[model samples]
Structures are given as structure tokens and as C-alpha cells.
Target: MSLSAATLRSLKHHNYRLWAGADLVSVTGTWMQVLGVNWLILSKTGSAASVGLSLVLQALPTLLLGLWGGALADRLPSRPVVLATQVAHAVLAAVLASVAMSDPASMTPVYGLVLASGVVSAIGGPALGRFGAEVVPREDLPNALALGSVINSGGRILGMSLAGMLLPFTGAGGLFLLNAVSFFAVIASILAMRASEMHRLVHAGENSGSVRAGLAYVLRTPRLLVLLALALVLGSLGRNYQVTMAAMSAGPLDAGAGGYGLLSTVFAIGTVAGGVIAAGRPRLTIGLLLGAALLTSVAQSVSGLMPGMAAFAALILPIAAGAVIIDTTVGTRVQLDSPGDMRGRVIAVQGVVSAAAGAVGGPLLGWLCDELGPRLTLEAAGAATVAATLVAAAALARLSNVRLDRAVLLPVRGILRRAPAEQAAALP
Candidate 1:
């Protein structure tokens, strides 16, 4: 399918609208909180490593706790799981805001609160991933997933931009307050959706044994293993974008927080665009995975090397686009291929891999920034990513009967039917 034509048809699902609306408001709060959190830490400690350390604290728990979260999701209904999580998140945000405002000198407690919030989010991640399948039909799953990506990245863009504006106005404390309010907005939206609208995925033999069984399934399936490997490699390398870009933009790039915000915004723009394109595509294939990885790596390399701001910004667009495409394709595939009961665990595994990346990547990049510089770190990582992509493609091609053409990712078999080619192409 042509890219232009595919965009329109992917948006017919009602679920996507609800998801997008909540996400639009919530994502901005997330971005604002992130920006404020970083600044708050930096101002208090006056150390780069502290900034990195805080992120490590926030993400490290996910590596340890994500699988458990997935297991819980499998045992429970996702609606209540998500709803409860949203409430917890909102309360955490409120606490952070109160602490930040009442005791400006006590940043340590704030970090503790952020760490607590991270743990809550780690548990919530799998539920959020599985929720898409519940809300939309199988046929619209990919599109819904893609639109989710668009909403997520679009939220990042607008949120970060607004963060840039709001942080200076209200200080980090005020931003936290606004973020707290936004969480309530998301919670309200989620509650407003009809219970009948949430359809649970009933996979064959969903009465499963242990989390190890899910792992066993992944291990037994060569394609799934390949996809997992791709996810691991991509997470390790791609996670460096934030640390590297932040350091470069603020230091050698001399762009400051605003520049960092601009860089992230460009990436967000690419993400939304990529999500749109992937939604319209016929199916997920090894070729698409390889292409996305290679394109992202190449774009990263170019962006890292470019000395001019405009050049770097332009390079970021393709990189962001590629990253989102890889994410959208892999994410949808994982959702479709897994059993409903085990889908939570599968998504949890993905989250754990990504969280593991954050745990390791942040400190590694920070140390690299201190020694070799951000550009060198980015260049090396980008090269490694491209190499990993090639290896993944080769392994995928070796499968005896898994032809790219035979793998139909669209219509999410046994799911809902979308409008034909005409409906797939329109935006909105």
C-alpha cells in the first residue's frame, strides 16, 4: 500500500480516539514532569552524575520488578489494573508537587518519591501495552498501536514544548502541580469510557502455568526470539538518545534546555509520522524491521556528526521516524502473536529489556560523555546498532518457511475488520 493512501484507512476505530485524547493530555504531563525532575535534581546537586543516578534509580526497579508486573496483569483484569495505576500515579504526582513546594531544600525526599512512582509505572507498563488489544478489534490493533505511538510522541512534543515554557514560569514545583492535575484528567478519561467497550482477548489455552512458560514459548519460537534480540539491541543503543542528546545540546552544542527540548520535539515529530506510515503498511516483515533499524542507526550517525544545528535537526527527523516504526511494528507483532493471558508477560519482558537499557545506558553514556565526549559515544552506539540490525536480518532470513510476504500483519486475524484501502489512507 502507498504511504499516503494507508494513513486514512487506519483511523476508523473509535477506541483510537479515546486513547489518543487521554494520551494527548497525559503525555504532556509526563514530559513536563521529566523536564522538571531533571532540572530540580541538577539544581540541588549541581552534578551531572546525580542527574544520571536519579534516572537509574527510577528505571532500575523496572528491570527487577517488570516480570512480576506482567504476571500480575495476566492474573487480573486490565481495566482495574490500569485504573488503579492511574490513581496511584496521580497521587504520586500530587505528593511530588507538595514536597517540592513546601520544602524546597528537601530534594532527596523528592527523588525517593520519583523512585516510588517509577516502581508504580513499572508495574503499570504491561497493563498499558495490553490495554490496546482490549479496546480495539484485532484488525485495528496495528493502527491503534500506531496511533498510540503517535499520541505518545505527539504528547512528548507538545508536553516538552510546554514544559520549556512552564518550568520557567512556575518553577519545577508548579510544573509538578500541573502534572498532578493532568494525571487526574487521564484518570477521568479512562473512567468515562464504557465498560462494554473493553473487550478482553481470549487466546487458546489461556489457562497458563508459570511466567517461565511464557519465557519457554518465546524461547521455542525462533521468530519471537529474533524479535526479542532485536528489541534488546535496539533498547541498548537507542536508549542513549536522551543522555547523549541532552549532554551535547547543553554542552558542545551550546543549546541549553531549550535546545534539548527542540531536539526531543523533532524526534517526536518523526515518531508520529513514522507511526502513521507503519499503520498503513501491509504487514510486519523482517525487511521492515531491518530497514527501520538501519535507517535509525544511519540517522543517528549523521545527527551525531553534524556540526550545525539545522543539519542535526534534519537528521533527527529520520532517526525518530525509524525508531517509532521499529517500535510500532515490533510492539504490534508481540501483541498479536502472544496468547492473551501471556501477552502481559510478553510485553513485560519487552519493558524489562527497555528498562534494563535505561539502567545501564544512562550511566554508560554519562561516563562516556565525561571521557570521550557525547558525539563519540553516539557515533559508536549508532554503528553498533546498525551491525545488530544486520545480524537480526540475517537470522530472520534463515527461517525455512517464514516468507516476508506470508506474514500478514494487517487485520490482526480473528480481530476486527477495518475499511479497505480507502479508509487506511486518511489521517484523522
Candidate 2:
């Protein structure tokens, strides 16, 4: 297939097209809110630690209930679950907008609203993943996932730029309201999709045991374990870009808000490029995932050492691209590898682990920024990610050796089948 055709294959499906459009809008709004909230906190408290606290509040729910949410997705129709979550998110956004308008001097209300939204996200995240899987044929899942990453990256670019432009006129309250409206776009699209056209899986029954089953499966699967391990390390140490980038721009670079926004835009451009490249790939593999993680970590480290804003901006391109490649490849692998009935649960497990990492890492990184400085913070995170990736590679190498031995034994077993049974046994 041509590059465009390969990258756009998932969009050929009517349902997937509708879903992608809705996702683009919703994700854009979400990114806007993220920037708005973080900026609002920084402006108020003038501390990266306060910004980190907000992120912790947003992620704590996922760490606590993400697995249960996944189990719920397995037991329920993804459409209704996703719809309910979207509605909840809209409501939360509206509440946040109202709070922002009220001009509370304290961070208490903002933290509470963020915590509530995080609760909804924890529950809806896995169901949303399953819903996306339903929209396209199995063969096109990787493409769909890559396209989803593209939307996420593109939305960040648009949202961050818009937030910067709008911050002066509308302030954070207006941005929150915009996000509230954006949720409806997704709700409408979900309503538009015909259930019959979706590649639905039967509900796995409403059993509490299902949650444990998902956890057990991940523990037992060597590849899944390795992937999750990599995610935990990278997510905790390196993925808190909102915190790191903000501090870097405002602190070390002395660039202020506009500069920070521009950096986000530059990074997002790289992510869009990475997503497009990932979409063109025919398949994903463990080796590819690990390699991407290593490259991303190395790039991040290099980005920290850049002497000027222009050079740092240039390095961020590869850093963001590498990160996107890792995310898309690992996400596609999770979807393709899991059993249909258990896919939601497996995804939830991943969400929980990642969220936990973020919760812990965000605060720690923020503190590091305060104590050591943004430059050292980025370098430390990159080093940690590199260490984690190497460990995962070593583990994967062991698994690869076992698989290779099995492959070699398979041909020997085949030769034995061609020989007389007694003679084959004697030769062995």
C-alpha cells in the first residue's frame, strides 16, 4: 500500500472516522484544560511543587481504581460505559469552569475538581480503549491506534497554542468551558455509530474475579510484564513533560508562558510525525518497543544539555518523536496480544501501573526541579529511563533465547516425525 493509504487505512471505516473526529476535538479540549490548570496553579502559587500536586490529584484515582474500571469494561458494553464517562467528564469540566470564574484564592477547589475528573477517567479509560477497538476490523487496529496517537499529539499542539492565545482574553475559566463543550462532540459521535457495524466482543460477565484474572495474566505473560515494567519506569521518571517543560521554560530558560507554549507545540509536531510513521508499520514487536524507549530516553538526555532555547527546541523534536513511537507500538501490541474478552482488563492494568508511576514520579520530579534545577531534572529522568530500558532488554533477551530454542527443537521434532518412531526414539 502507498504510505498515505497505509497510514489512513483505519479511516476508511465509517465508524472509525466518526470516532477519530470526535476524539480529535475531545483530546484537544483535554490538552487545553491540562495546560490551563497547570498554568493556573503555577501562576497562583508560583511553585512547581504545587503544579505537581495537581497532577498527583489527577492520577491518584487511576492508581486506586483503574483495575476495577477495566473489569467493568469487560463486563459491560463499552458504548454505554464510555458514554457515561464522557458525560461525567463534561459535567466535571463545567464545574471547574464555574470554580475558575468564582476566583477562589485557594487551590482547594481546583484540586477537588481535578480529583473528581480523575475518578471519572479511571473508570472510563479502559472502556474507551475497548470502544476504539470495536470501531475497526482487527487487521486495522494498529493503524487506528497510531492514528489515535496522532490525534492526541495534534490536539496538544492545537490546544496548547490556543490556550496561550486565549489565556489573556478568556482566562482558564473559558478554557474549562470549552473543554466542557468539547465532550459533547464525542458523545454525539458515539451516538451516531451503528452498533451492528462494530466488532463487538461478548461481555465477560460481571464477576469480581475478572479483575484478578487480568492482573494474573499480566504477571504470567513475560512480554506483557516487560512492557509494563518499561512503562512504569519511563512514565514515572520521564513522562511528566507538563511539569518538566513548564519549569524548564519558566526557570532555566527564563522564557515565560509564550516560550513554554511554543516548546509544547514543537514537541507535539514531533509526536505527530512519529505517529504517522508508526501507522505505516505493518506490525509491532517487543524489540521495536524497547529500541524506541532507549532512543527516547537518550534524546531526552541530550535535550537537557542543549545550551540555548533554539537548540533545545530542535532536540525536543526527536525526543517527542521517540516517545510517540514507544507509546503507539506498546499500545498496539497490548490491544493485539490480549484476548478479546480480556482486552479491557489488560488495558486497565496498564493504565493503573502507568498512573501510579505518574503520581509518584510527578511529585518527585517537581521536587528535583526545585532542589537541583530543570536541567538536572531532565538528565536524571533520562538516565533512569535508560537504566530501566536496559534491564527490560536483558529480560527480553532471555525470553528470545527460549523462543529460539523452541524454534530449533520444532524442526528436530518434525524430522523425528518423518523417521520410524522406534528409530527416532533411539537416535534421541
Question: Which one wins on lDDT?
Answer: 2
Model 1 — TM-score against the truth? 0.85
The CA-based lDDT of model 2 is what? 0.82
For candidate 2, lDDT tens digit of each residue in 30-56?
A: 989998899889988999889878888
Q: How does each model score on TM-score?
A: 0.85, 0.85
Could you tell me how far off, in angstroms, the CA of residue 90 lies in candidate 2 after the best superposition?
1.6
Q: Model 2, which residues run further than 4 Å from truth?
A: 39-49, 105-107, 206-209, 242-261, 367-380, 402-428
> Model-by-model lDDT, in order?
0.74, 0.82
Writing each residue's lDDT as its tens digit, candidate 1 over 1-428 gives: 56565554444555556767887898889989998889888988898778877787788778888887887777777778888888898888888888777757756887798889889988888887777677777776777777777778878878877888887788888888888888777677677776776677653244563577777877898878888887877777775577787888977788989898788777777788887767766664445566667667867766678896778888888777778878887887787877787898899888887777666766677888879887887888888887887676656656644433222222222112433432222100
True-vs-predicted CA distance for residue 137, candidate 2, Å: 1.2
